[model samples]
Target chain A: MNHIFSFFVLGGIIAAAINGKIDVVTTAAMTAAGSAVQRAIALIGIVGLWMGIARVAEKSGLIDKLSHLIAPLFSWLFPSIPKNHPALGCILMNLSANILGFGNAATPFGLKAMQELQKLNNDPDTASEAMCTFLAINTSSVTLIPTTLIALRASAGSKNPSEIVGTVLFATTCSTITAIISDMIIRNLYRRRKYN
Target chain B: MTSEMLGESFSWFIPGLIFIVFLYGHIKGVRIFEVFIEGAQEGFIMAVKLIPYLIGIYISVGIFRESGAVDILVKLLSPILKVIKAPTDALLLSIIRSLSGPAALSMTMEIFDTHGPDSFIGRLASTMLGSSDTTFYIIAVYFGSVGIRKTRYSVLLGLLADFASFVASVYIVRKVFL
Candidate 1:
């Protein structure tokens, strides 16, 4: 993040000096900060509402129930995870949170899942296959309803804030499948090379 | 056609989700209202916490744009973007989506402000943002916590997913909206 920040800032300065747009850059930097706050303020209500409901879902065991629904597929994805193991449960919870787009809820469970997977690892320092798979899944998890996204769009005065929901679902499904398939193929290749 | 049908029903999706969540909570004997208030307070805090990151990203990206740097960069990548069917404006969001969440959000904001959120690029940005996660951040935190040194295939897998989602977002958006 630090590097990205400095790059954007210094890059902008250099480009402005070259283009003679220092005045425009100054004005943009000034208002951009103020506009960011305004956007965040506009975001509070909807994000709050969604988070509230997400909490209700979590407390009600709806998240657990949803995780249970995906348990069969979960087993198929991480067959190495022992059946009914704590790691499996943790992974389910994390993936459930991700699918709901409750990122704040997802992170803790994800970390816990990684810890459990580490417990099963042959080497503590090197990532195991399960850990790699879990990492892949989390990074490209399927999000069904991206609450923050819809909120941002609505705040931006979108004609239809939820209109992209279907597209997101399809796109994420494709991405997740791509991640899984590529991980499997690469894992196979690595194993072959190691044995050969 | 199927996507269009699904998109059409989205208006009721959130309302239904909320109703189900509350109803399930009630059935489970959970204190829905109290829990909701508690969570909403956390949400408010999250929003406040985001202010600094948002300010930093928006200012830099905004300056970058006004300075005409973004245009030059976009032009350099325009050929690749055209081949991928991604809008020139939404390209940064797609790349940044895998790297940083705040920066991607700021870029989306800039895109919406320049091209109305209902525009093709705007919708493209939203779909890309919604579908993808921050790959590098996920790898760092999850692997970092577990003290895993060799990420091996993780980086390749995560980036492949990110790239696929970007391309899929572009194709799916054009298919559904255009």
Candidate 2:
């Protein structure tokens, strides 16, 4: 994180100097920060809206029912999670929120899932198979709605703001499928190399 | 399904989900209003907490784009990108998409502004942004929070997934939109 941040900042400044865009960079700094705050404010609206609904769904047992609807798939994906484990529930909720594209709502659930998975870690410093698989799938983002993109397109005055939803579904599905397969393959390879 | 049909259904999906949430809450006797307010407040807090992260990324990305460095990298990678049949315009987006959520949004917004949101590049950018999470950031935060150092092949898997997402977005956008 530290290196990437510094690298981007320093590299950009150096490149600006060579490209004689120091003035542009100076202007960008101000405008970028300004836009960042504006974007955050806008985020507050959507995040608040979805998280609110998610909370209601969670409290009303809707989310639980939804999780149960997909529990079989979760179990298959995370066979290592012990039956009735809290981490499994957390993982389910997290992935459900992710698939629904309620990303802000997903983060808390994901963090909770990580902590629960941590308790199951035999090697304190090493990531377990379940942890790796969870993180891999989480990072892959199996979103179905992608509310953010749709909202952005709407604001940008697209003729059909929601049109990307279909493409996003296809794209995210591909990534998630790839992530799961790769996780399975690499972990097996890791186990074989370590044990043999 | 046609894009228009898919879009209409999805557009209804959100409102349908919201209505079902409310109806279910009412049926379950949840303090629907209060719970919603509480969750909404949490959302405000989360958004506030994310501001610093967003500013940090936005500034760096803004400077990087302003400096023309991104364009240079795209140029240098054109041969390989061409060989792979990847859209050169989306190269920086896919790289930054994995690194920073806010940065990727900023890039997508710029693309939309430059190309018009209905254009092929704009639609492609939209799909790309929605296609994958910020893989590097997710790994760093999730594993870092757990204090796990030996992350093994998760990072590789995550990037591979990200690559798959980009390729899928490009292919689907071409097939459906172009």
Candidate 3:
């Protein structure tokens, strides 16, 4: 994190000098902090609302029910996990929150899921097949509605702010399928290499 | 239902699902309001923790874009992009959207201002933004949070997914919007 952060900041300034856009860089630096604050504020309401809903769902056993309903599918995806593992439940809720565009709420659930998976890990330093698979799924999880994108479009006065929702659904669905397939293939290859 | 109507219905589905959960919690004898407040508080804390990360990434991306680095790359990549049938202006967006979320968003806003929001490029940008995650940022934070150092195939698969989404976004936008 530290390395990438400094590299981007320093590299950006150096590149700006070479491109004669040093002035632009200076101005961007001045406003960038404000933009971050604005971005964070933008997330508060959406995050808060979804967090509440997720809590309701979890406390009501809705998440557990949903997980059980999807257990057969999850079992295929995560064959190593027992059919009734808590990790399976966490993973389901995390994916559900992500699909609903509740990214902030999804993180805690995802982290909890990772932590639970970690407990099942035989190796501490290296990522397991399950962890890698989870990461892939989380990164490209299919989102049904992209609220942030829609809000941005609407605020920009687009006539049809929600028009791209279909496109997002299609694209994310494709990517998610890609993620899972590739993950399974790669994990199998790694397992083969380990045995060899 | 038509695809557009299906999309709109899904948009409403989230709120409806939440309401159902609320009612279910009430019937199940769970203290909905109290649990909700606790969860909201956790969300706020999560938001707070992300501030520094968000600021750092946004500023770096802003500087990079403003410094014309993005322009140089876009120009260099124009031929390949044209072959892919993607707009030249969207090159930066496709790359950065997988790298940093705020940076990509700022770029999206820039595109919206430069080209009207209804333009093909604008819709394409929005779609790309909506479809993908910041691969690097997610791997960093999630892996870092769990103290996992040796991330063997996670980054590779994540980038592949990002690439798939970018290609899918462009293809969908062309087929649907253009």
DockQ of each: 0.47, 0.53, 0.55
Q: Please, what are the lDDT tens digits per residue for candidate 2 over residues A1-196? A: 4565577788889888988878888888899899878877887787677667767877787756655666677788888876656677668778877887777667766765776789988998888899989998999998877767877898999988888888999999999999999998898899899998
* Fnat measured on candidate 2: 0.83
Ranking by TM-score: 3, 2, 1
Could you tell me every candidate's TM-score relative to the true structure? Answer: 0.66, 0.71, 0.75
**TM-score (chain B) for model 2?**
0.62
Off by over 4 Å in 1: A1-71, B1-77
> What lDDT does each candidate get?
0.78, 0.80, 0.79
Off by over 4 Å in 2: A1-71, B1-76
- Candidate 1 lDDT by residue in tens digits, B1-178: 3433544565565567678888889999999889999978876776666566667767876777668776677678788887977766677677667656777899899989998889998898989999999886677557755667677778789989998998899999999999
- The order of the candidates by lDDT, greatest first, is 2, 3, 1
lDDT for B177 (candidate 2): 86
lDDT, candidate 1, at A1? 38
User: lDDT value for candidate 3?
Assistant: 0.79
Clashing pairs in 3: none
